[model samples]
Target: MTDIEARFWSKVDKSGDCWLWTAATTYGYGRFAITKRQMIGAHRFAWETVNGPVPDGMVIDHLCRIRLCVNPAHMEVVTNGENVLRGEGLSALNARKTHCKNGHEFTPENTIVTKNPSGNGRACRECRRAAWTARATCPECGGSFSARNLARHRTNQHGGSHV
Candidate 1:
């Protein structure tokens, strides 16, 4: 076995569903101190030691949801988005939500999509309409207007020549 593989096996307990890391940990996940400034995740290192590079934009996920699990059989390579959606956390809960805070169902016609750094989110059309109307305050008269009425309101109130 390679030196990394040897080091990895030495720290594993191997006594339960999760071949728990017996070495140091960070934030409840196994942490291996390779060098003074070369510390890395023990589970990730284990995956690399057995498999290869984790793949671009892909992360190693514990099938058993054990942060300390370094068992190669329990690891799967997946995208960050896929991992988040599969996890039992707040992000997963939000991803599974089919309705907006206002109780509007997220249908294809009524749902507005937004791309974010973490993932995409849907907004209800009714809530969006309300927001567009409520937020479109006139710079000239400070009056709110809906999307359909904003242009006419701006042109008529500002005399159409107000730059």
Candidate 2:
């Protein structure tokens, strides 16, 4: 192995946590501490030693199940979304709740599909109707449009127009 690789491997603790060389600088910052700096250094060392370089749009995950441990052997590269799903712990996995914020379960009878640039998604029609029933004035001009047409009346009648 090269000198840099050799130097990196020499800093691992018995627990597999990587450490930074006292002489090494991070992002031009100063020496590595045993705690915070060591964790960051370990991640960097693991990436550099095994992967050579970390490409953009990729994240290193701790497969060894230790966030502080930085053994290159324990690290794996994955997408950010996958990392989040993996890190969400057990609660998300066990969660069976799919209701809207207003307790509207996403059933075909109560859900409506709206087409947006992002694609079609389910919306609770009951919530929309309830929200519509609670409004009094046009949000744009303060002219009365009732709860039903408040949003549309604002855009079509009062939008970009004074009074």
Root-mean-square deviation of every model = 5.9, 8.3
Where in model 2 is the C-alpha error above 4 Å? Answer: 16-41, 63-65, 88-97, 106-125, 134-163
What are the per-residue Cα lDDT tens digits for candidate 2 across 1-163?
8765566556555442443233445553222344443544557566776778877898877765555555666678888767755665553342334787788887878888787885445678899888767757665566765576665676677556433
Model 1 misplaced stretches (Cα beyond 4 Å):
114-120, 127-163
Encode model 1's per-residue lDDT on 92-119: one tens digit a residue.
9987998899899888899888889967
Clashing pairs in 1: none
Pairs that collide in candidate 2 are none
- Summing lDDT over every window of 10 consecutive residues in candidate 1, give the lowest-scoring window: 129-138
TM-score top scorer: 1
lDDT score at residue 34, model 1, on the 0-100 scale: 75
